[model samples]
Target: TATGKGFTPAFVQASRGWTAGQWAEARDRLRARGLLDADGELTEDGVRLRRDVEEATDRLDHAPYEHLGQAGVERLTELAGAFTATALGNGAFPVEHFGKG
Candidate 1:
């Protein structure tokens, strides 16, 4: 909602299975929490909130493979890219997934 174009009602409905009212309520809560401004832009705290959440999510996602180390992670990404080439060229990105025998 902050950096990109805001979601349309249809997009929110289709993607999140949320009605417009539900989506608005979610935004309202964010505003009430001081994470968003009246205009729906992210406040400074909102940016930090997003960062914190992303960092935590990243940690949680990687916690399972910390023992793999940097090298292992790189190889995993490369293999994942090859495996998901048809669907997503970005590979191992949105997913920490990888593939290759």
Candidate 2:
């Protein structure tokens, strides 16, 4: 089920369920639309558009929470790092050694 790396057959199968021709047609349509280049990379316009979208989303949706101070930020950062390490560690990070209150 390999459609040559980066292109996952599982993702394609889930989306189209058995249509290489359909996928190719849709892919070609995207290339025609100037969103994807022939080499499968996003066109310059597509990259700029995606960046614009992300920047606009951040500008419109995210704001600095003014309530937290420097000390609070430091405490939160430590807790977040410990939590993430504990959850995702492969015996590499030892959160318990840091001790808990």
Candidate 3:
């Protein structure tokens, strides 16, 4: 996930696998589909839709293993922080965004 107020489409596109042109094209398609705003930010409805999709994905990712409880949640949170550090090259936890505190 992105940190802080975040950056422009250039930054986001660079982070993903798509080239700038491909990113632009895909972004246009998404905007046309009402998934993004004219400026490329997510619209209010898009925000809720994305949140629901993310929740569903999270549930699916956690559903396969049984017997996971509070302890498992804590462990997964820690592991997620570690994963963000290793994968993103940033060691700090974006607690302000994730509401961990």
- Candidate whose TM-score is highest: 1
TM-score: which is higher, 1 or 2? Answer: 1
Q: For model 1, what is the error of residue 96's alpha carbon versus the real structure, in angstroms, after optimal superposition?
A: 25
**Higher-scoring candidate on lDDT, 1 or 2:** 1
Residues 1-101 of candidate 3 have per-residue lDDT tens digits of 22114444445555566797897788788788787887777777777777898889899886644567778878878998888779657734343333322
- Each model's lDDT comes to 0.69, 0.62, 0.65
**Winner on lDDT (1 vs 3):** 1
Candidate 2 lDDT over 1-101, as tens digits, reads 11322445445455558677777787688678887788766788767766787789887753442357678778878999998888767654233432221
Instruction: Let me know the TM-score candidate 2 reaches against the reference structure.
Output: 0.45
* TM-score on alpha carbons, each prediction: 0.62, 0.45, 0.57
Write candidate 1's Cα lDDT for 1-101 as tens digits: 55333444454465567877887888899899998898877899999988898889897887646878889888988988778785566442332122121
Backbone collision tally, model 1:
1
Weakest ten-residue segment in model 1 by summed lDDT: 92-101
Candidate number achieving the greatest lDDT relative to the actual structure = 1
- Looking at model 3, residue 85 earns an lDDT score of 76
User: What are the per-model numbers of colliding residue pairs?
Assistant: 1, 0, 0
